[model samples]
Target: MQIRDLPYADPGVPDVRSGTRFLLWLGRQQLGGQVKCLLWGLLHHLGIAGLPLGVGLAVQAVVDRDGGRLALAGVLLLALGAAIAAGDVMLHRTAVTNWITAAARVQQLLSRKTAELGSVLTRRVAAGEVVAVSTGDVERIGWFVEALSRFAAAAVTLVVICVGLVVYQPALGVVVAAGIPVLALAVLPLLPHAARRADVQREKAGKATELASDTVAGLRVLRGIGGEELFLGRYRAASQEVRRAAVHSARMWALIAAIQVVLPGLLLIAVVAYGTKLALDGRIEVGELVTVYSAVALTHHALRNFEEIAQAFSFSRPSAKRAARVLSLTRTTTTVPKPREVEAGGDLYDPLTGLRAPAGLFTAVVCGDPDVAGRLADRLGGHPTEPDADHTSVLLGGVPLDELPLEDARTVVLVQDKEPVLLSGTLRELLDVPTSGKVRAEHALAAAQCDDVLDALAQASVATGGDPMLTRITERGRSLSGGQRQRLALARSLFADPEVLVLDEPTSAVDAHTEAAVATWIAELRRTRTTVVLTSSPLVLDRAHCVVLVHEGQAVAVGSHRGLLATEPRYRAVVTRETDEELATADGRAVELDALEGESA
Candidate 1:
């Protein structure tokens, strides 16, 4: 396949048995690219090796005063130079191609695995590890793969040049050949230490990255709870640890590099001194002495490849291990999916919680604990639930929801998570998914009260022919406000228009007016579909056809919002958080504070 056709239509199932196996699997997948790289690299190095021979021949031709031979030497030099240049260019191009395509293939595989695991991935793998795998680890793995082919080429070039030298001049050739092994093996002792230090550095870096992300995600909460400094201190300490580990790792690698340099220089000096004595004593010709010197000098380049490949493996091995570990994550919190379709038009029932949403109706679930509500929502959609509990799978039309094929189950029910992500793309790209063709994008945007968001997006970027859908958004919608991002996510979910829609606190981030508008539109939009909303907002609950109150992990009450409020004391206190007098007193305090601020102004 062409390099442009990379990231294969199917990346194929990866072998996540172990890190080394995974790396080998990646290499096997790109065998064709690797071969091209190896071929071009060998040609490039061979061409380079030929240059020293041509120079030696030219020197000999000049010494002999043979005009025709001298001219032949010049022509050979020109031809070899040209070959070297062309080979170098093609070699680099192919190697980089292999690197990029391999990385892309791994990225595609990670994305596919993530899509399969969903929430189960986060539960099983650390956030930092995933970040490291998706970002730095991918590059490291590709680097190793790219280096492998070049290293092979360098090794072959060194051997071929040594053999040629030996046939031309046995005495010097043997000396140079003997030293090549020493230069290659001199740094072997330091490799284990360097690898260990690098692994430590990588581990420290991953931890720091995870800590930084967590701090940023909850910066507001941290400040509110007066723990910002605590987290900042922790991140700072983690950063310091990473820095120290990196410095120590660099020192070890630098020592190996010094050894590579000093040993090769020593070998070159010995070869040159010995060759000079041979030339002066009439044991070898001037040109032969020069050839021997240049050949030994050239072997230094090949020797460096050994070190390069060794270091590449040291770094990439751990990276591959982390990536493989992430890919190995299974849905331990849920049962395996069955390869069958879920029957349509069935009640969404969670047996563990004894909560049932009748077919083709808007059902609202209220749980004081957001965690409980979230778990319930996940159970409704056949997602990971409490790992400690052996929760029975939710049922859809009398069939286990988790038993259906992944696509079939997802087609039947889409759970709009509490914090739906907005990947960077044009608005159209974000909303354009495998939809049911019932609800249009425009209608979804309108229903979600995203008109302001659209206008803001258009005004933010008019370059897309003034089309809001064509407007560009930054990653995670960082440029937009929380409510705006939330609305856009809701619009995307609505556009899918699944047979059964389960939204967990969909409108929580929105303003009261927007929430009220969205709640009303949602009731109208999915009036005929089996829609379940987990929310405690009075605005959303009042609009539901039925509201189920969950307490201590079970459905304790089921009725209309008004009826439950009027009759259920526990539900009323949990939802309202205050009695009538206390609520009035809180309002009075808010008014008094406002008046005091007005007087101060």
Candidate 2:
């Protein structure tokens, strides 16, 4: 594919079993490009091989004083030179196209995987390793892919030259031909050591990159805690280790390069010394000796190509393996057959936890442990805790959620976790998420209590002379306060207005007053739709139509805020966290009020 046509129509499935298979798969994907590269490379190298024959013929014609033959040889030399120049230009163009296309394909695969896995991707792979694979590892893979065609052409050209040498002068040709294999294979013994060093260097570099990324991401927290110098020192140590590993890797490669040069030079010397003896003894003509000598020099160039192929393979193998590892990660959940569209606003139920959010109700789940609450929230949205957790399914409107297509499932239930990400973009761009369009941006923002955030953004925009909606947000909204970012994310989720909304600790980052306001507005806003909030906050829980108290991974009690306070001790402790006297007063008041109202009736 051309650079402009990128983001391929389909980045076909790859073979991820091994690095070698992945590289071969890439070759097959860009077969046409590879073929063109090989053809042009062959033409270029063949043209260079022809030069010696032209010069040899010219020398013979000159010695015989045949002007006509000399002129013919001159024409042949000119044609070969022109062919070499043309082939060189085209070969370079095709090779570059191959390189860019390969890298683009790998990048596309990485991007698709990232989108599919979402936050779970970082849990499975290190953030730094992903970055390294997408950037440097991709280039290494492309380099090896593009180098393959040239290596093939070089091998073919070497063989042709050897055969011609043998036909022209057998004794010297045999010596040169035999030496060529030794020269090419001389560096094989050092490759294992070189590759091991390269792997070490790559590992160190990934760690250093990950360290830098983590440090930058948490720079604000570090500075607040007076730990900036500690992190900086750690990063310095990682950088130094990376440098040491790189130096060791480079030393091994440098030794291989020296061998590459020395072995070819020795082969050339052997050819020349042996050819000279043949010429002096009248066993070979002067022109033939010159021809053999030129061929040997050209053969050295071919041998260098062999060394480059070996080096490229050594470096790219690990990169390709890393890429394959990422590509091989398929979703563990079984993909069910697609069904017709189902109605929205269904009752969400998780069989594993036996927690149910009835249709069009505001249900609050209070768990003693936050992690258990989070897991329940995930299951409520048809997101299985494990890939093999299909047997435990969440049902929507009596249909097993795992049976629904991913997109349909998302439309039915949207889960907003505690730490939702806000991508860098304008305010409008951020709010322009996939939605049912029932809730307007203004209404959603107001419901999420983001008026202050909007006012801040508007003032900043005014100072910068831009529209409030067009105000640019920094990465992850880092420039905004924690509460501001949280509110913005909540606003975005509210704007989606899905059939079922599962919010996990949505108001944890806000103050009590703001939390109360958000709790009130959210109930009012989602009154017509099903909403499940996983929280232990009294304000949010009190506002829910019903509260389910989850204890030890199971829903132990379900009732209203007042009823739960009077009945379930666990629920009261989770929501109020009060002392014995305070708990007695609250529970007595709730029970006495209920009894007094009952007596009046």
Compare the candidates by TM-score and give the number of the best one.
Answer: 2
**Per-residue alpha-carbon lDDT of model 2 for 1-601, expressed as tens digits?**
6777887999989999998899999999999888898899989999999888888888888888989988999999999999999989999999999999999999999988876655556757888889999999999999999999989888888888888888888998898779877877889999999999988888888899999888888899999999999999999999999999989999998998898888778888888888888889998887787788888887766677887888888889999999999887643255655564656766788777788889999999999888777767767776554653436677888888767766677677788888888999899999988998889999999998988888888888965575678899999899899999999999999999989999999999999999999999999999999999999998998899989988997788988988998778778777777767887787788899999999999
Report the lDDT tens digits of candidate 1 across residue range 405-456. 7778778888887888889999999997989898999999999999899889
Per-candidate Cα lDDT values, in order, are 0.86, 0.86
| Every model's TM-score | 0.83, 0.92
What's the TM for model 2?
0.92
Q: Per-prediction RMSD in angstroms? A: 8.1, 3.7
Candidate 1 TM-score over all chains jointly? 0.83
